[model samples]
Target: MRLRSLEGRLTLLLALAALTGALVYIGVTEWPLPQAFAWMQEAMGRHASVFQPSRVDIFVICALVLLPLCWWLGHIVMDPVKRLLRALESAVASYRDGDFSISIALNRRDELGDLIHMHNELGQTLREQRQNLAQRELLLDTVVQNTPVALVLTDAGDRVAYANIAARHLFNEGRTLNGLHFATLIADAPEALRKAIEGTEDALFSVEMDGSEETFHLSQRAFRLQGRPHRLQLFRRMTRELSRQEVAAWKRVIRVVSHELNNSLAPISSLAHSGAELARRGDVQRLPGVFATIGERARHLHGFIDGYARFAKLPAPRIAAIEWKPFLDALALHCRFQLQGNAPSQPGWFDPVQIEQVLINLIKNAHESGSAPEGVTLGLNVVGHELRIEVADRGPGMSEAVLAQALLPFYSTKRSGTGLGLALAREISEAHGGRIALANREDGGLRVTLVLPQSATAS
Candidate 1:
């Protein structure tokens, strides 16, 4: 407004220069043509004067006039620059302290206006960034505090710094966790737990608490907080999961036992009453057959119960070195059906008794699958240092649902089965560092494969 800007100052200087040139032209023109011609003639030995203002005098007067104006204009321009610098300093200080609630109120339409707008934008951006950071921290804190997993945080000196709700309850009956040494909290802890805290390994182990035992799955990690190293310990309780599984297993066992006992007891009771009536009517001819039927059922019940006992009480295998061919031959000699398969020529390490028991069960399942003797096949081979013993049967294979639960204890497809044979086979195979899998062959049959680790069989 006061000719203190680029556009105003340029215009002012141009107008002043034009005004000075006009004044000099008028003054010189008014002086006299005759005087100017005389001066020229005198210089050539003749009297003539021609009038023109000398360039030096005009330039000197212009310099004197512009100097004071330039000095005044500099003050006008520099005053605004100094004020802008002060405003910038204040904004910078506010931003340094993480406060961005400021806006330059000036409305000048210049480069300074753009700078003020940029500062406002920067302030808004910084405020948004701070809000985002705070929200993320809040979310993370909520999750960590509310989680069921016990979390204990320790400083670089192994002193406990913080603990969540679960950790407080686990370590000293909900006492304060601050200022306590980490070692004191976990005094005489289990080896597995110690290893977990040291970042060496993870484990599931039990610790004595309140005169009873409690199981915990342990994990650990290291991190930096406020530029200092910290460690975190996580303990997840496993007692609830284990108790649930145990209760479910007991329910299954009771149901199966009740069903098998009922099957035998009902028929035996009916036969006893019928035999009594036959004797009273003097029709003793069927009495002996009734007694015989009762005996058979009782014996069947006994055998069924015995099978379950054997499966539950199977002992650990006593590994021994033996020839695979001779062992299979001995089993075949005593088997109900003909056995087939050329065993590997090498000697193997395993419990001969346990391996034989597993094979006997598989063979029995195969033989009972169908009426054809050729429906069953025995196969033995070494695949990638694994000893595979597979028994395939040409009977109807299991459906998806049935196969899923086939390995469960007391679960069976056959109506008369006790469901112990395959379970016992699985227990023995696993004891020898082996596992069994069941699959339906494409050609319409079920194939059970036993895969034993090389270390369990190789000699």
Candidate 2:
């Protein structure tokens, strides 16, 4: 029924041919004689009694008049149809060649107008769909390439399907990661990943990887693809985060340690000079006790100085393969002195020796901040590869002024406090590539936390 199709065109052509043949036959066989008879009848009925025209003359005249009229009528009717057919044919050819811009103009209020309208609608729809697809593709490309963090997409089988430039460089050293396995790219991915893919549980993990001597935190998450069982992994590096914390801890240590050393050494020097003056004055009865007191104070001064020196001269780590369980156990045993009196319960997964020192200093500070029976509580935990060691005190928490200067060397709230202990503890943790921070606990206490690297093993 559609006039735009090839079959319709053939039908129109056949109808036009049949009409032309009929017109030709009528003109040749019946038109001339009828015209001649009409002319003779007009003459006889008006002016002449009898009138006859020769057949040859009559035929010639009739043909001269009739042929031109018939041709004019055919031209008027068929010319427009022929032009319309040519336009339609051209449109069809262009459409077949995948060009949708061609439009046929049909001014008549007829079936041809309807055909043109339908064609225009189809072309516009195609153009819109194409434009929409192009825009979506461009957006997707821009987001993937320009984002700062690495992005990797894998199929259900854990085969790499797509990876952004950042991800490719991180895993494959600038090479493409089109067909590698997810397990192969990461050095010994945890079993959590496999469980995530299998839909057993959600996998969210934060791990520390060995980067030279420094540790880098990598946070990972797994998500399922839309309308599919496939999983996707996302990773982000947290090295800068840890670095910022370490720097803050270092500032605290330097401020506290400097204040403590100045306080003790300055007074010790004056006391020694005073004892020498007493001996010169011949105060024999008081001289022995004064000299002995001077010796005792000097020895105490030496011990404080030695502690500060050790704190300042923390050595770089000589890394080796270490079993975590055994390492923590040994570290705890070394902290027995600190844990002896009114210590908090044992914390989880801490390098006991380092943590013990930190706790001893915090406990000592807490004891000095208040009277007896108001000691501190220490807590440690390993939550998702992050070591959180907290030293909380039941005594009054630090004031704004004290908290502000808490990490500075030799800065203490007490008159007799050396202040080197906390500074030393912070420095030791930092040397192990970790951090220490102090804050007021929510339930009215001072809370100090030391965050350290979990492990540096290859897996």
Best by lDDT: 1
User: How would you encode candidate 2's per-residue C-alpha lDDT over 1-459 as one tens digit per residue?
Assistant: 777544565577667666765664565457754566667878668666544446676567556765666676667556767888898788778878877677766765445556667877877776677689889999989998777667777777778878888888767888999888877766454453444344533334444335332232333445666755555555555557667867876786666556655665676677777777877886667767766766776787688768767766765554443444554356445332122223222323334555556666766665665624434554555555556666666667878888787776666666666666777777767766688888876777677788866652322
Model 1 / residue 181 / CA error / Å: 9.8
Instruction: Supply the global lDDT for candidate 2.
Output: 0.63
Q: Least lDDT summed over 10 consecutive residues: which range in candidate 2? A: 336-345
Relative to the unseen true structure, what is the C-alpha lDDT of residue 457 in candidate 1, on a scale of 0 to 100? 40
TM-score of 1: 0.56
Question: TM-scores of the models, in the given order?
Answer: 0.56, 0.38
* lDDT of candidate 1 over 336-417, digit per residue (tens): 5444566777766678888888878887888788736677777877777678888888888889998888887777888877
Q: Total clashing residue pairs per candidate?
A: 12, 14
